[model samples]
Target: MVRAKSIDHGIPGRGSFMPMRDSIPRRADRDTLRRELGQNFLQDDRAVRNLVTHVEGDGRNVLEIGPGKGAITEELVRSFDTVTVVEMDPHWAAHVRRKFEGERVTVFQGDFLDFRIPRDIDTVVGNVPFGITTQILRSLLESTNWQSAALIVQWEVARKRAGRSGGSLLTTSWAPWYEFAVHDRVRASSFRPMPRVDGGVLTIRRRPQPLLPESASRAFQNFAEAVFTGPGRGLAEILRRHIPKRTYRSLADRHGIPDGGLPKDLTLTQWIALFQASQPGYAPGATGTRIPGQGGGAGGRDYDSEPNRAAVPGGRRYGPTRGGDPCAPRAQVRQTKGRQGARGSSYGRRTGR
Candidate 1:
């Protein structure tokens, strides 16, 4: 549970104090506030300064979330002409109001996601709550109201959000429209009552045009989902299940692909090529061989070795090989000896052994 500190108005350089009638309860009063709200405040002065520096807004309208203890709020007030803060904790909101007082800061005691962004706000900045960070980001991304945003979030989440190609499906889906990059990492020890995990700051810039067409985007998402279903299965097997068998064969034929199938190490481009070739009436040149159980020519010869040998009918010798090598001579001799032994002494007496 997060509790907001009491507002102290008389302090010099501190902003005006405004108390919320329904502010978040004090930690001492109720421990549940922090637990439920995920309010881990940013207490490091250097980190606060770095976050402000990364935002780099002067006289611009800024929207901030979770301004715990006024640490980040103070900086925002100093740098931006109009800094609007939405803090769930009433005490913290009061502290921010008193600290910034007559300066350019407006403290709103409410949930950030529910709060509306002021019109014409160009920049959004906050040390966002970890639990709702994804939702908040999605809201911001979906809204065209802000020009850009700088956010401080959990290091792992930030890494996934900003990572290339290897990021989560959500990140990949959104990548075409927004560019996310990490600015720096803030140590866990830097925060007061330090959090268990470290933090990172990231900047996001929205793009004007998406990378893929709307139709292709859906297909790509479906493709990604199918490929990542199981860890050990080959890519070809997965694709074959999702795509039509005839379609698969046709694509293999058009692209000159081997009957076997695509290899596990096939690149993204190659996968895309295979998908493209599957489209009606497309063919590619054959370049690679396919393994059995995936796709290959008839005869089913072992690609890497001689055909497996099997036992011959009514005899101990094995079947003949294609190379004309009969069963080993030792095998024939062993068979003859076994037959003689079966005839036993009776035959030996009759034949005058």
Candidate 2:
């Protein structure tokens, strides 16, 4: 029988591409897949509850990216009024759909990246596929639809997004709009196939008072790219390319940012001050800023890519473009904290898409 893949998402091997093979899924045992992909799919019941507990569903619907085995989906339906899931594996998509037939869950069998995010989906929660974590996050950050997301991503990713030790290129690009925080750490043992790295719970909440206008996203993304990739060891020297040394010195004096601070050490406020001080005078068609390594040419990562049709896949869409590329969303949700996820064992199945 063609059983579903492991808990999280399939472990994709290095330099090895796993095709969706919607028409012909080769027969293989679960262990063989683990050996082939090195995937860490989430399956631990306690971990599932823990992951869901981080989501603050304030009377809004929840959209799950990859409801592998439906463990997290099960917990979500118990508290939220409407639950929507996108599973790429045909068998598991059918399986998850069957499990929640009567509940207030809407199961769509399709790639989350290609899927058209439904309107008014305020909260997005998932044990995301590790391979395309950055792409998936970029997709989410590009859209102004949802207000918050609670995700179980790679440990390093969690810390970086939360800006714990230091910020990453992606995190710095989005810092003006969202607030990232890292919660608990999930051990490798929590997964069925047991991935090599541990998972971390991360929460993303939109800022009520954005330092910059949403219209300036394109310019800001480019501005960030230049600063991060600038040719200097310290920010003071690097920023000299954008702003005059006199201005930077004055700002540093006022903000208390060390003159020798590295790019990673910049806080949100400091970054905003630097950008505003530059006074790029953003016009409608200003040079499109791209997220470094996320796009091409003079411009950076372009948010205006192919539109999401929200089409229903007849068969399963395995790993083929499983992430990246999502359209707008419906509404917003105010992330509510301190709510423990309710337990569930309805369908009783653990193996998932």
Candidate 3:
């Protein structure tokens, strides 16, 4: 069991408040919430404390994605001067409003994806519902107001987002500006309604000095998406035929990338160096080359094609284009039928959002 610790911030007449240990709704209400939201409430005080610690809120304004019953929200109010929670469930939003009524808490009942984040908000923290984890994450990562965020999500999702073992295209696309870390994994038993999978505390902090400028962010994203979805046997092999063969060989030799290495297998620094090397003017004679036997696509695939029409090597496929808000919407919403992070659900799993 994790131990819950109290924090004192020397604010007169202002402090945090937790609903009575028994104040949560009865089992019947819990069941209804579960059905409606497709999520289990995080009830462990210790886990809440752990999440707060991971957030590193040092008096900055915070926007919490979901505050179901205010377990984590209570801690935020104590640590930060402003705590605004975006809750999808009206019942729980009303409950949290009444609980933190007079304090710095502002509860808004709405989909976090559609809700406009405040200008002064500097940090985001929450134990977000698993059902909409992908959507919420996209919204947060795309928004530029927040400098850091701590999120509690499904274990595998956390691991992938943090780029454990290998990186995803989404992680690679954003790695130029943000840093991801997996703090700890809480067991499924930690929540009031145990999830089939454990939960992980993940944090994302923007770098003080980003490697790539914001002006180049879109180019970098398009480059990453192209590379990940480009055709060839492996990353090195793909590069060999995609770029000028001499330049590709030089990069491989300089970076020590083996001929059979995959895109996901490359390190963050290597990916940066590679992207730098692939720029139009960075290296001369960098027009793309075609392999004799390979199918035609060295950045030739249209990003706006129909679903599942464009397939890449290694069982990877390019997703369809999202029309508006490049930051908020994914390149593609993989599964339209089920909630993301649901049991056996693959919604947004392909994009690794």
Best by lDDT: 3
The C-alpha TM-scores of every prediction are 0.59, 0.71, 0.73
* lDDT (10s digit) by residue, model 3, range 1-353: 11222111121221122222225677798778667676677888899898888775457689888788888888888898788787665557667777886787766555565455565677888887777677667656665656789999888888988988588776777776788998799888998778888999989998665555554455556667667777888886677544667766776775576778778887765666566566666643233222223332122112223333321111111222244221122223333323421111232345545
User: On residues 163-200, what C-alpha lDDT tens digit does candidate 1 reach at each position?
Assistant: 63245544544444456888799998877667899999
Error of 3 at 326 (Å): 19
**Candidate 2 per-residue lDDT over residues 226-337, each given as its tens digit:** 7766888788889999877877777687566787888788866667666666764522222332223323212212222322422111111212133532321111111221
**Better candidate number, 1 or 3, judged by lDDT:** 3
lDDT of each: 0.56, 0.62, 0.64
Segments in model 2 whose C-alpha atoms lie over 4 Å from true places: 1-39, 280-353
Ranking of candidates on TM-score, top first: 3, 2, 1
Winner of 2 and 3 under TM-score: 3
